[model samples]
Target: MDDLEKAETVLQALKTAEQQPPQAALPILNGLAGLVQGDPDAPLEVQEVRADVFMAICELGKALHRGQPAEALWAPALTAAKRWRGLLG
Candidate 1:
């Protein structure tokens, strides 16, 4: 998915994680993580996106590790992701 779509998916996943299974959200995170890890020769801007994605994953992991609410995690992550997406546009 594109940046906007990925940001939207992550935000939505955060919002309804209680109602939707982890099955739904985990894959989106996993996919974004995979993309972030992939493609070394990407443009500088895209590399920045990878950095944002990595940070987002770190936030999510940190929240899960701390047993804290995801509000703190996804808010910034979504902002970064959406900003990255906007740059792409």
Candidate 2:
């Protein structure tokens, strides 16, 4: 409901998506982006990590859609998700 609550939800989603398919991370990233919307007071780190997540999701999708192996995206996606979670703390 509030910024902290939204951040926590984003953290949980990021954590869960870390070990799942990158596709599973897309909705979570999108949700977090929407949550961060209008949050002009959000920390700079939060904004940066949200942007990272958005970029990572796009890259992951592109790789997957191009018939590349899902494993190729997993590590980077997990790393970015972890970074996003840490930045929120």
Candidate 3:
């Protein structure tokens, strides 16, 4: 899949993980960890998008830690991440 698609997939996985307990989500989170680190073969723009995605994921994590319910945080996080992805596009 293309980088934006890949990034979206990763974000979706993150959202799913957010809905579950942290221990249950660890595998999905770990699976997605590398894509945002930017592979050497990927375009710079894709790398930048991945970085934005990573940041958004971090924000979501922080929100979760701060006791924000998944229901409340998911939409805003997804919206922000999509906006960042569009900018990268």
Candidate 4:
């Protein structure tokens, strides 16, 4: 598939993975990182959104893995996902 198509596929995977319990977020975040890294042809907004999503995912994963409350990470993830949706639109 083309880069854009691949990126969209990754993003959809992220979205689906985010809906699951915190235990499932890390692998999906790693997948997103692989999809976006070094892909300079992607739109600036898309790249930014993906980066935000990646960081948010990392934070959530860290929090969950460290035994912190999921709610502490949930807001940022939701915000990042909303921003990603806006960028996609």
Candidate 5:
């Protein structure tokens, strides 16, 4: 898919992540990362938010593996995801 489509998919995945278990959300985030693959052509704001989203995903994964509560990650993850969605407009 194209970058915009990929971004939309990432947004959807992020939304889904909010409701899903950590086990399920991890793969969803991974899939969104793979879908976009860090589109170099995107604007600086989009790139920044994308980086934040990816970082949040990585942190979420690490937390899950470390037995930390997933709740702690959702706020930042959702914030970044919302920023990303706003950038798309």
Candidate 6:
């Protein structure tokens, strides 16, 4: 799948993973990070999105790793995902 599709997939996975153990989410977070870091040929707008999403994922991952409740992870990541979706329209 394309990168955008991959991101959406990762986001969906993250959403589905709520209330589960943090360890279960780490690999998915890694996948999201790889998408952000893997693209060097993206245009400026896409790169900006990648950066924002990357930051969101990083924060979410850290919180999860620290044993924070899953509810703490949703809002910021959802906001970032929404912004990324807006970029396509």
Q: Once superposed on the true structure, which residue ranges of model 6 sit more than 4 Å away at CA?
A: none
Q: What tens digits encode model 6's per-residue C-alpha lDDT throughout 43-82?
A: 7787787688788888878878887765766777867766
TM-score of 4: 0.60
Compare candidates 1 and 5 on lDDT and give the better one.
5
Candidate 3 vs candidate 4: the TM-score winner is 4
- Clash totals in order: 0, 0, 0, 0, 0, 0
Better of 1 and 6 by lDDT: 6
User: Candidate 3's residue-wise lDDT over 1-89, tens digit each?
Assistant: 65566667776786688678865665665666565565667666555666766766676666556656545655655665566457545
lDDT of 6 at 56: 81
Off by over 4 Å in 3: 39-49, 55-80
**Residue runs of model 1 more than 4 Å from their true location after superposition:** 1-28
**Which lDDT values do the candidates have, in the order given?**
0.60, 0.61, 0.64, 0.66, 0.75, 0.70
Give a tens-digit lDDT track for model 1, residues 1-89: 75556545555544454344345555555555654453567578777875876788677755555566665566667666666556555
What TM-score fits each model?
A: 0.58, 0.56, 0.54, 0.60, 0.78, 0.72
The residue-level lDDT of candidate 1 at 52 comes to 79
Each model's Cα RMSD: 4.0, 3.7, 4.0, 3.2, 1.9, 2.3
Q: Give the poorly placed runs of model 2, Cα more than 4 Å off.
A: 1-38
Which ranking of candidates, highest TM-score first? 5, 6, 4, 1, 2, 3
Clash pairs (backbone) in predicted model 3? none
Put down candidate 4 lDDT per residue, 1-89, tens digits, no spaces. 55555556655776676687767765665666665453567688777877876787777667767767766666676576666656655
Clashing pairs in model 5, backbone N/Cα/C closer than 3 A: none
Model 5 stretches with alpha carbons more than 4 Å out? none
